[model samples]
Target: MTPVWKKTPKPTELIDRVTQAFRLAFGYEPTAVYSAPGRVNLLGEHIDYSGGTVLPFALPQRTYLAVTPRQDRLLRAVTAQGDAGASASSSPREIELGAIAPGAVEGWLAYVAGVPWAMAQEGLVSRDELPGADIAIDSSVPLGAGLSSSAALECSTALAFDAFAAANTGREPLSASDTGRTQLAIACIRAENEIAGANTGGMDQSISLRAHQGSVLAIDCRDFSTRPLTVDVDRAGLALLVMDTRAHHNLSDGQYAKRRAACDFTADTLGLTTLRDYFESTPTLAEAHQLVARWEEQVTAGMVDLPPQTDLPTARAALRHALTEIARVEECLALFSTAETTEQTWAQLGDLLNASHDSLRDDYRVSCDELDLAVNAARAAGALGARMTGGGFGGSAIALVSQELVPTVAEAVASAYERAGFNHPEFLLASPAASAAQDR
Candidate 1:
């Protein structure tokens, strides 16, 4: 919709920086550089672990890695962070290949070390035959803003190591085939969950590996199936704006984990295995709604006993958001799959986005005041719709705006932040970008 971003810089820009950093840190030029893009979840938040639908788009911003194979069982990993990233508690160091276990590393380095640990566990590469790597990382994706920068780093790490594995095993280097990419994404998920201790569903890694330029991925979190639906918002005079609130979020902090656990508890209360089971087990949305409505009423009546880490109010809230968001996903996908898009179509989608924000704020209880202010300001400035994206507690928000209003709306948001005495948040203009680098 945005003319395929003719002036966007190639991954080569970051590749050059990562290569130089790799050389400086490891005393050798790395064999090759690989990168992966961060993503902004447009809708269907928090329902990922329920095996519900999630819509996400890749950002032009990305994380990059330059890797060299080591003959010995040692990995030298480092990152050249900007002044902003200097607060990271972990420093550059070498870790034994066998010692790359869960909780073996701390802070951001844990996410990096986790990928190879997952690869080995999955038998994608043999521990004995694996060539440990020296890697240097660099990223433009903003960290801890609910934008999925961790997935970007894990994906690039997977891509780089996959190539090294191919060379070691006499297999061809990693290709961009859908199946191969999906498997790699799962590996990345394992890294985040098992090693990095993020405990998330696989939506972030799936989007990182499966995103396409000018499209949004409608992912079925159950089986990791995805359909790339065209998001020609610009053709209808609309644009997608990511407003980074600069209020950091950490998924490992137990609240996110608590939400996932609550969803599971709701599913169990509904006599189903997962939240998406409503669609698979019931014949109609009305029937399913009736089922959860009973539980909701019970929850409201204080008849149900919720876990100590959660409460009846929280469980009721989780169930309400999950059922409604799943229906919204189906409706949004149906409209998006239409042959041609019009102004009316974009308007309907905008309404869905706004509804999504409301649910995330009130039902999911994840939106913070900073995120709320950004969305409200964007809408006040003529955005069609605005909503908090990602895991929500103090993160970023996305707005659907007409292209002509982008500058004016952006200015209004900054002015509001200034007037409120909050830091002027980082504004990112995003359409879709390609999922992975070109086939190697």
Candidate 2:
């Protein structure tokens, strides 16, 4: 059987439903409703925290938060659930604004309450001036699918706080200017890292806040600077298909933290600020191989300081993946700089995607069995290239296929999963989507 396909909800309907839910939960009208898109990283994986560049575009599926500032410093929040087969509805939680802090809130609620705390702690707003809010969230972004669902929630909350700050403090809206959006993105990052305890990098928040329709954002992780590249695959008869493996993936778990630690250890031992710095110096695939060989020699000679639980091989693999992934992003950027793309241009891009997945699976050790199966199956079914696109313990894979072959590719993946006795996957055709903004 062909797997199920998900569709993006109409924005007006989503806004209306969430607004009604907000009125029922808080007994008042919301000041405004804001939304942010989840993102799919087209290329570059597991290299953001290493200060490497990445390319990602926004997903139409979004999280909508209807919020209103309260007169007093108390946060009341609720969410609509059970559509994805979880709880029917989340129990409303009330939190004192003063009590907001890192690790103070737990479960999914931290993603909401931590925004105000992060904004104040990061100096985006004053703690005394911060307003308490009542939020009701309804999202279509699949949770734990490696689709940046948590970032979507945090970014939408960030926009809500910015709107209130603009009204109360006489400051301009942060989402109105690129500079302001960057600041908002930083606050969201802090919320995820400190308040939510995810230990993730800034890619998801950056793309969610800074992306533009009909384009992908190329983010320089070192400075978080971005440039939009218009890659119109539809004109070339290609479609980007997202394959949700239905395998559980959670970044807040310790597994993600360990990988970040390994990357940091590799940087410290190599005497570089980050692996990206080294990539800048040695920017070719050949140079990356040579550098890895030299590092292996040093490890064997007992000249490198190895962390207790991390060995030379793991560190070497992590460094290699970061450096090579950076180079692939550079190549992809160069390809997009052309005035028009051809079949050959896409073939080259496809080659890079295939290589990226191989590196993540073999070198970074992130891809799981389900992810591997989906990617391989898609490629076998005439996909130009396919790769796992998220945090990768078990998440979604992306396939680049001709528009006409989409159904064929989807069926092939479904058959593969059934033969393996894995959960049937879901599918979506991802298009470039807008950044976070007030919907009402």
Candidate 3:
């Protein structure tokens, strides 16, 4: 299957408008317009922050930006979807870009402003940097849907800026080597982490920059190394259906922060810097569980500090659960890459999905009533496997089903939800999609 990078509609429009705005503002059209996709974790929820492995595939949804260099130090940015006044017109909103410090702009603008600021800080751009030019940002990825929409925005902006720099330096057709897509991606991720203050891992930006269609990205968060597992999901007569709960998930929520704190405390208790270290040294669930149990003793005994009344048992359970879930993520990748028959692949995939949900629910303590209800309904309606997919407080769930049963499955789940006095959920039939890329 071709990755979703080619299918993003809003980014495509945004690219065109930004290119036009740059031409108007700088008297020269951009050499290239680029886009990067938001991703959905096929498996491995909360593991990214835990410094474990993650398997994320780029969605068809993405953010697009277009840009060009300028002769002056001002940066102008406009979004086709932003609050552009009648006078402002869909043209670029002129801003004194080089004058603003790292944390000058707040809210969504930080992602835009921070990119250039970070690049300047990294010495990638000199004081005489291509000043700044007009940029237009647009995206179709659902925000706060646990799909990495913010990553898409950050990456697209960074890519556009990098492309402009390369073009200005007389570098034609900016390649990965010339533009340093990896470095730019990391910069965007840091912008989110440091400037934006969201404690998310770099998985989104990494996948956005490095993912390939017909594959799953196996990311080792500790060192940022990656391997692309070529997965074939075509023969199973099955589709991965994503249902949006329409519930917003904030990464800075206390629950999320608490879990991360607990992981850190556990790692420290074991004389490790990250849970990844513990996993690497101890390869079995039993060994990991023993280590976590000891870590819990320290938290309970006040030897190790807890994150303000965090349940020791709950935290320990979460840590152990993360260990098992990481193992399953690896297994799912193997199954996807090597399964002989579609039925067998679906069966294996479904089992892993169900197992993953159980871990999230019982051990990780992230699942909610709404998510549980959806999973139950899908199972009752004959879904091969169904579970909440993301950070799980109120995002969406994925159901693996035979193509013939999709409608029945969706209706059953939606009806069950309505009967429980909830809003009718939106169900999307999704498949493994490709990573984001620039439009030709």
lDDT leader: 2
* Ten-residue region with minimum lDDT total, candidate 1: 1-10
Which candidate model has the greater TM-score, 1 or 2?
A: 2
Q: Return the TM-score for candidate 1, rounded to 2 decimals.
A: 0.92
Q: What is the Cα-based lDDT of residue 167 in candidate 1?
A: 74
What would the per-residue lDDT of candidate 3 be over residues 364-433, giving only the tens digit for each residue?
A: 8888777888788888888888888766788778887878887777888778777887656776655556
Task: Return whichever of 1 and 3 wins on lDDT.
Answer: 1
Ranking by lDDT: 2, 1, 3
lDDT of candidates 1 onward, in order: 0.80, 0.88, 0.70
**TM-score top scorer:** 2
Which pairs of residues collide in candidate 1?
none
How high is each candidate's TM-score? Answer: 0.92, 0.97, 0.84
Instruction: Determine the C-alpha RMSD for candidate 3 after optimal superposition of all C-alphas.
Output: 4.6
lDDT of 2 by residue, 1-440 (tens): 76789876799989998999898887889878999999999998988998888899999999999998888998988888532437536457889989988878887788888888888888888876778888899888988888999899999999988888888888788889999899989989988989889999999999999999989999999899999998888999999999999997988888888998887887788797877876546367777777778777888898777655977777778778878888888889889997799999999888999999999999989999999999999999999999999899998999999999999999999999999999999999999999998899
lDDT of 1 by residue, 99-211 (tens): 98888877777777888889888877787657778888888888877889899989988887787788777886544478888888888999998888888998999999888
- Please report, as a residue range, the 10-residue window in candidate 2 with the lowest summed lDDT: 82-91
